[model samples]
Target: MRIAELGRRTGVPVPTIKYYLREGLLPPGERTSPNQARYGEEHVRRLRLVRAMVDVGGLSIAAVGEVFAALADQDQEERGLVRALSTVEVAVTPVPEHEDAEAAAQARAFLERQGWRSDEDEPALRALVGVLGTAREVGHDRFWELLDGYARLCGPLAEADLDYATDGPGGWLEREEALERVVVGTVLGDAALAAVRRLARKQAARRRFGNPRADCGTEGSAEGGSEGPAADGATAERP
Candidate 1:
């Protein structure tokens, strides 16, 4: 195939394909003449994978390079390849997986049945299910719960992303910004959420007990057996 046809097939521009070839993300095409070159299925597949890494997965060029090298490494296990491809599929596909779609459908119904208005999150939910499926196969369901808690934030976060994605010069630029929003925002929001919860807990303590050290000696003790603010000997012994 020609470069134009390659770009058309990959949804990448012709110049971008050239740049990818230069960057070693895609291999050089076979030279048919001094100025003529022909890309084959390997080039197409590599280009698609490259596009998936940068465009959908939102990986930095350097990061994508590392991942590509890892994929090429013979030492990596099949599961590593599977996980990498799973990530690429999740990033590339427009919708969530069928298994995740079913799970999210059931979850949405469960929510509606409980009188909660949950916007459908088939893609996000399906992605979660896929992650969980992989996680379960590895015997790590607790990690799935941790990821679920993070996925819980996607609705509100996606709304924020929609705000930026819909604003300003609506073209590839805007679309690019939106994809960055989804990727970067997930990392930022998770960290922000954790900080907010910590701060909120401190603020709530101030209101309820009027002390930064309220939990120091609470009746129930701190959550998960964390030591309260009270020094062990500060409080009198109880009968």
Candidate 2:
């Protein structure tokens, strides 16, 4: 297919595809003549991946390039999924500014209590430390009380995530395709999980503390209930 056809098939504009080509996000199509090139299904798939990284994952061009570079670094035969994922995750996750040392210790201690082994430099761990530090700074120390429950709940979520990534819509995929699915899953999954949690919280709150006089079809009202705790705890934020 020509560039125009590739664009039509992928729903990305030709000019934007050219931009991605220049930015090294998309590989150049095979040169067929002085002014024309031919693209294949691989280019189509790559363009879709690029769009997902930009639109859903909210990655910058540089970050997408870094993720591509990380994917390229994986050995084709060995297909180091873990290493590729780690590199991609590091590329996408913002490095939090160093904050409370005690918060960092507490985050690590929480991981230890959960029997989770991870390097101190892990992006998620650092993010947790940052969040904990921020909470402490804002006088939300009570938020720490729910940390264990969050971890416990997240364990099943991780397993389910892996299951969905591996057994995708088309069933088992090749290593490269599977890696792509994992990338999209990890990025978009966080958003889906967060939104679902909010919905669940609304439902749970309605069941537990909603005003009895309020119409069932309407939004739950906590008119007669005590003020809910902050930082996403139910008794505080739900989960």
Candidate 3:
């Protein structure tokens, strides 16, 4: 297909596709003539991946280039690809040098206590510390106190994620696809999980209070009598 057809098929504009081609984000199509080229299905697949990284994954062009390079490197083993994808995904913003040393130390300690194999200097670690520091400054120190519970919840999820990624019926994913999946999953899965959590929270609230409206705060009057939208509103809002 020509570039125009490629753009139509991918729903990307022609100029934008040219920009990606110029930026080294998309490989050049085969030169059928001096000014015309034909792109194959591989180009279509790559363009979709590029769009996902930029539009959904929120990666900068340079970071996407790095991720693609890592994915294409034949020498990188599975573990290396996973690490490289994660590093690029999480290290989009540089860690501030002035981040609180105490928070950094605490973050490192927490990781150590959890027996996770993360480096103290990792950008993700620094990012955690920065958030923790901000939480303390905002008088939300109890947020950090909830780390253990959050970790416990994450433990099973992480294990399940790895199990799915590495134990497919045909065996683990191919290196390139695995790397792409990791990046895409990390980016999109957060939104998916947040939606799931909200539904779960609504269900739990309904079970605990015997009425979802009662947990919405408006129905929880000082008299302790539930008064709000009756079954109709409840059914309308039910997940």
Candidate 4:
């Protein structure tokens, strides 16, 4: 197939596809002529993977490049691939000035309690510290109380994720394919899980609060009702 056909099949525009090629995100196609190149199914697959990482996973070009480099490295061991995947899986935002030493200590302590081996310089650990610090700064210090419950939930999920990655089909997959699956799965699975969590939260809120109508009280009168003051300083009275 040609570049045009590859773009059409992948629903990606030609210029964007060309941009990916220029960025080294997509592999070069086979040269058919001086000005023509022929792409194959692999190109199609790669393009889709690139789109998922950039558009859905929200990875920057640099991050995507790093991920691809790791994926393409024939000498990378499984442990190296996991570390690479971890780096791309989380977004490392710039840390604000005036760090909260307490939150950082708390995060370290929590990690230690969990018996998880993490380095202080790891991006994920740094990100966690930043989050914890910000949570405290925003007066949500008690939010850390949920750590234990969240960790419990994460333990099983992480185990299941490893199980799927390692024990697929017969017993263990080819190293290259396994690495690719882990990268793609980690990227796409995060988005899928977030959406599911949001949906579940919506359902839980509806069940607990009985929807907007219940929260706003019966039709209009605020007398003896649970409806709070409206934003405009008006009482919600019964119709």
Candidate 5:
């Protein structure tokens, strides 16, 4: 296929496809002529993966490049996918700064209690320490009480995640395709998990607090759809 056909098939514009090739996100096609190149199914697949990472996964071009670089560094015979995934995680997560000794100790203790053998240089451990420090700063030290419960919840989630990444359709896939699956799953999975958590939280809140909106709707209907000052003020105060 030509570049135009590749772009048409992937629903990506030719210029954007050209940009990806220039950025090394997509491999160069075979040169059929001076100004024409022939692309194959591999190019189509790579373009789709690149689009998913950029559009849905919200990875910046540089971050995507770094992830690709990490995956490329893996040994062909013994692919270090975990290391590649770690690189992807690091790219998505912000680097921690301003170490808090007390919070770091707390994070370390929590990890020890959870039996998680995290390295000292791990981004997540550092992020946890930062979170603990911020929680204390905001007078929410009580949040520490939920750490164990959160860890327990995440254990099953991690298992499910690994199962999803490793178990492909028909139980077989090329290494590049497997890596693509992992990248798509990890990046988009975080977003999906967060959205589901928010939905769950909302449901829990409704059950616990008894749907304030239900009463508000009734009151508004009784008042001929004229929300009173208190309702107006509350609405204004939101967001």
Candidate 6:
């Protein structure tokens, strides 16, 4: 594929893509000819991932770069992943969305029940309530049930994050850097959560109910059967 095609697929402008290339944010494309650079499937995949991180995941360029590096490092550890995931910031931006009466009622009820103060952006709370409101509107009861379990798991987790983020590395975080961290953390953290969710499901089945598929003599399945590299390539190194 050509650079034009990459831009088209990624919805990024050609000049911006070139800027990324120049900034070393993106790897150099193969030279099809002296004046023409040809991209391939790898470039396409990477560009899409970058766009998703910036546009949807709300990552800053520096943070996005760090995340891309950590993702490809293969030599990274859990702490490295934590560093990458902590690069994005969550701000209290009013979305300017008009909430329907019922949706408002549902969200209010959900938040009230969860005891989450809406005084801040509250990414975790917003995500949970949004999932519930959307689910109820779509005629599903399982979303609330899922939220119940997830909330029980996440409440303490949030406290842990607060403890660590404030006392650990993120404590030194500057304001401008917060956005970058917010972006990186939001994307990597989501990936981390996905890794955990996958493990949790397997654990609920294998050990919670005692399936024989897992190796015996342990309290639970190893790494809870996490994906690809187990929990992450971060947790276990490849020899």
* lDDT tens digits, residue span 144-195, model 2: 7789999989998887776665674346667787678678877778778889
lDDT of each: 0.55, 0.79, 0.73, 0.75, 0.80, 0.59
Candidate 6 global TM-score: 0.44
Error of 3 at 178 (Å): 2.3
Q: Please report the TM-score between candidate 1 and the true structure.
A: 0.35
Query: Which portions of model 4 miss their true places by more than 4 Å?
Result: 74-77, 90-98, 167-170, 212-239
Compute each candidate's TM-score over C-alphas.
0.35, 0.82, 0.79, 0.81, 0.81, 0.44
Measured on C-alpha atoms, candidate 6 has an lDDT of 0.59
CA error at residue 80 for candidate 4, angstroms: 4.6
TM-score of 5: 0.81
Give the lDDT of residue 181 in candidate 6: 43
Q: Residue-wise lDDT of candidate 6 within 1-239, one digit each (tens)? A: 89999999878899989987876678899898999988987677667667777676556677666655644453334454444443233331223233345544566666678886674235444544566666777988555555556679877766655444334644645432433344444565666777888988877876576544334444334544543444344433525
Clashes of each: 3, 6, 0, 5, 0, 9
- Superposed on all Cα atoms, the candidates' RMSDs to the truth, in angstroms, are 14.6, 8.0, 5.6, 6.3, 5.6, 13.2
Top model number, lDDT: 5
Q: Candidate 1, which segments miss by more than 4 Å at Cα?
A: 75-239
lDDT of 4 by residue, 1-239 (tens): 99999989999999999999999998899999998999998898888988888889888888888888866764655675576567556442344455578988988888988888986776666777788888988999987777877788889877767666666434677776677667777887778888998989977976797645444444334332454556224433534
Using lDDT, rank the candidates from best to worst.
5, 2, 4, 3, 6, 1
